[model samples]
Target: MPRSLKNPKKAKRKNKGGAKKGEASSSSSNGIPSIPAKVWQPGVDALEEGEELQCDPSAYNSLHAFHIGWPCLSFDIVRDSLGFVRTEFPHTTYCVTGTQANSAAANSIGIFKISNISGKRRELVPTKTSNADTDMDSESSDSDDDEEAVNDGPKAPVFQVRKVFHQGCVNRIRAMTQRPHICATWGDTGHVQIWDFSSHLNALAESETNISKDATTVSNQTPLVKFTGHKDEGYAIDWSPLVPGRLVSGDCMNAIHLWEPASDSTWNVDNKPFVGHTKSVEDLQWSPTEQSVFASSSVDKTIAIWDTRLGKSPATSIKAHDADVNVISWNRLASPMFASGSDDGTFSVRDLRMLKEGDAVVAHFTYHKRAITSIEWSPHEASTLAVSSDDHQLTIWDLSLERDEEEEAEFKAKTQEEVHAPTDLPPQLLFVHQGQKDLKELHWHTQIPGMLISTAADGFNILMPSNIESNLPANTAAA
Candidate 1:
């Protein structure tokens, strides 16, 4: 752990679920074990001890939830945010990764079916005004728009864990199109497994504690592909953004490997224990827009850009941050623009073209009070970026030198004319939790601009940004 972080659990509880009074409950429906409800209604009365509440078992039309896992890290690198992907169909299900606190062994993973869910739950944020950060229409326009609101009904008990896989929790999860499955790599264990939604029922049955051997069917078994290449606990995996049958993985070894699954259903390694850093390789990203480009980060405090087509040292290596880099992301629409987060508790936007060995940071943001845990650049928008951290907050930043109206009109106009005028500016986070859990990994739905999704350590999450204002909700007042 970086000496910068004293208590890994010293969570700041920024966007939601912090205070009481006037704060409306249920911001973006994220972090629930099951898929969230289409509608969520707050209770008329305050929650009492031992009380349970029922959450929508189906995808949250408007909201979701997650659990507080180990202090070592979170459950999922991808958290339930808004608009990653959501459908009204009841058959659509999401998965959550689990992590055992302080385990040297890789944390196991778990599966949760939204269907089996229907129990007591609580609004992470009990206050109404405090949750008012992003949803301008949620408070006043939903009723007029004729969207059915959550009934101001009685509450139920909070959710509990039901399933465990691989004996630990997932550190990161990525969807591979070729395998057409979700691939999860645990925190302590150096193993990665690929699972499919088709295995939903089998995983559910296998996960249940009371379920007997009487269960039958092909869907109940989770067909797995475990890669034994990484010697240390694996940190991240990205399915080849270009090729379908190939995948890339990184680990504490400070190197990346390409795994080719041949026709025989067996896997072959094309790269050896290549080395890049002296510390753990925390994250890696293969650029979808570029076939030969990839970016990686590590606790060793360096960022490397590799052309897998080449064999020697990285084509470009930048001393990125003072602490461990947790995640790396690239702007698909913008060439040479990428982002990275670190334990030093900051994130940087670097222009690969302008980046130099020691001069790594192009623009930096330091709002997070804890280590920046995860980061993602907009797939469509160039200037918008979203980040999550150990501090339990998600922030979007816009880096356009253009958005700065205060810039000397002469300078701004000059830069605009001298430089290629982009249809957009820098990066910006459009909607925060609107009052919800800390962000984990965030994915934008294939084509939806405002819709995004995230998964927390606790459970499942799917989010849709509401037509709302941009501001942290009012502070939660004590009851």
Candidate 2:
């Protein structure tokens, strides 16, 4: 008998919505998907029961027990159930797994075929597929209009992801201001590899031609361009959301290179890496509501906002943190406002127009017991931000309407637990990439507004929308 059938009955619905105490939720509406309950127990035990138990078949979310090494990551993407059953789209899904120290894995990039997205553990396909199949087009008529997502609580995704890129111990992944294209993945290797997701689609097309004899030739949209002008790894790269194809990349060399990606023939260096920070640059973000204006933070304990059209001097500077600035995010809901986290085990948000020091911060987001790695704003929602850190935790912040701060106590950062509540709108989130090991990078599926792909410190994960009802699932509305 097959393992899936051994204890075949669907595990009792612990709760159709939230996880038990000390238990984590699996899906991600923001960029960092939380660890699944199924994988968490074994992991805790692994820390106690030893490595073998961590590798046991029971570790898989499914009875069939597909084991993703202990240090893996999962991303949540979106999909079209009807199209998937008809095989219209790639239904591309993935999970990034890592190699233990001294393990023989070569730090690879991977994509998995996911037919279902209803649980924490995902089923993998035998053969590889292209990484295209997303909803990049600002306009589209080809979608499952009747398809609905399952647990579309705040921030859940309702699309699909096709491809991913991974390198070991990633430094950061950032979305460019450019339209439907441009994302950067960097590390300490002195090499900042900017993945042109548009190109991933073409790679998929080329691979498709070699596989099925009847497969039709599809479009091959490559990443607009890739760059390697730095002599060292660019610690930070940001796209001028105001101008498509324009990028600014920086490295430990203390130099910022402006890139014209379309032609790749020109680059301009800021007078002196936007001097005045007086230390190494750590993180950056383009003002969500402003064009050509962006913010940068550094170990010098300050934050600087710049306008590329203006001279090399920072437009405004603030000694925002007591330690190295780790992550920065411009609030999308409020103008002239942004947030920063530091090594001091604290985080703060500032208003560009204000000169007050710590007095300028709107929310003091601190729950991660450690340094925050990054803070990403929701492209679709204002004030809603996602934070990830070395503390092995992901926290979501909503400044609009507090859900009664009186509710839950164990749910850090957030005053309460959502219990995987339901939503009236379709999930607009793309990928929620929570790494199995230390998280390195995350990417959103282009073309598909609500899909995502992620590369971890280990491998890669392609997330699809399982909360969305599937046409193939016998009990789905589409069925």
Candidate 3:
């Protein structure tokens, strides 16, 4: 059976409204036909009258969305000391996001502590087609509509947030693995600022209310270290996982700077920048196991592997994509495997061992129809990945999946209905989550298995799909 099928008896619900019957006989109040598309694409398919996206409660382990007043261009999941490998529900997680406010003075770094993420798991009623299928369709529609109406209102999770005044629009934000309160921000003013928000985090933890106004006013909002060495602003930055406090920042001018810890809270960024890519460096990822090694994607349509001890040049470079490579995610569990997303709405996985033998790319996919915005590998599942694109879709994929003809045939026979999917849709495609507008970036919670937090123009979405399995035992719970 495919990884997408959690239970053979309960098939995945593709569309909320019953599949289109035929040409519409009459229009509905919403100025659309009464029928909804079988498979809706964001830009391609239009919704029929009275057609709205209805969430299947059974399809989600936990789903919640919230807004922070401003749209963040980038955000990172702050690893908390709240025990690793969390499996139980009502999880708590910390995060930091940089805002692209209308005015530079209005921009601030937002730190959030979200909790009580209870599951929305429900058992779906099996649909039975009888009386020429029309009677069954109406019954299904009424049942789903009632469920959606009950869940339509905002179900905001408990959260505490703090704001630190930033000098300019924050292009990207990253939190250190060992010390999550220590965060790095790439500002539009061409400066990278390192801040220690230990006070803010401490106050938040102590606070009892959902909003932490005391914590918001407590921090000095001063960066421990500020480096203006980069001539131009950039979005690419990453902290080395192997070495604590080791950081790297890449710029639009094709310059990458390495930062070493000078003291406990300060960094000594090398004046000399690492030069290799001809165009802007789009993203950076440090090797999870190798202390001195890292990888970079660039607007030059290539991916380069670099080492800090190997001078200013890249160790190896590959023409990894047809268009500008926007993002890259190095697999933490499987160090040899990494993935890259491009401007042309495509992403591919590569293996370092195969790259040395001239066969770098292991699996390439083009399911997204717009520019790939962000991509990341699951910390728990080495073969699993999550990608966001300009197409307004956040897709989760399991690369371990392959087409199973026998399973498909058996599923159709047992369910009495074929699963609705395009012929070209890969079996590896596990889930497609929509509804967020202009999705910017996404990250998997390192401590919480199957949990994903994404930011976009609208706000933030914290979700864990029901179908994705976690290896962590149920006894382990979040602190």
Residue-level lDDT tens digits of model 3 in 1-479: 00010111211223322223223434454466444324455655676653455443444566666555567888999888778778765578888887777777767888878766656432232244332211111111111212221224322456678888988788899999988889999998999999998887887777656763233452346799999999999999999898899999999999999999988887899999999999999999999989999999999999999988889999999999999999999999899999999999999999998887885899999889888989999988989999998777899999999999898777667756555555667899988787666677999988888889887676677778777878678677554
**Model 1 agreement with the true structure over 1-479: per-residue lDDT tens digits:** 32111122423222232112221233324433432212112222344443333322111224433332332233322222223332322212334444444443433344433322111222322222222222211121111213222343212112223333444435555655544335545444577655544354354434523221113221233535676667777766777667765667887777677776674245576647546677787888888777766777878888877886787357777788888888888787786788888887778888776664457467887656677766877654577677766554455555653444444345546434332123232324333342444345666544334334454433234444332112222332121
Candidate 1: give its CA RMSD in angstroms.
13.0
Best by TM-score: 3
Local error of candidate 1 at residue 30 (angstroms):
35
Rank by TM-score, highest first.
3, 1, 2
In the range 178-213, model 2's lDDT, one tens digit per residue, is 333345555445655555454443444334222221
Task: Find the 10 residues in a row with the least total lDDT in model 1.
Answer: 136-145
Q: How close is every model to the real structure, measured as TM-score?
A: 0.62, 0.55, 0.85
Per-model CA lDDT versus the true structure:
0.49, 0.42, 0.76
Query: Which consecutive 10 residues in model 2 have the weakest lDDT in total?
Result: 1-10
| Candidate 2: regions farther than 4 A off | 1-170, 173-187, 192-199, 203-231, 261-272, 356-359, 403-436, 440-479
Worst 10 residues of 3 by lDDT: 1-10
Supply every candidate's count of residue pairs whose N, Cα or C atoms clash at under 3 angstroms.
80, 32, 1
> Which has the higher TM-score value, candidate number 1 or candidate number 3?
3
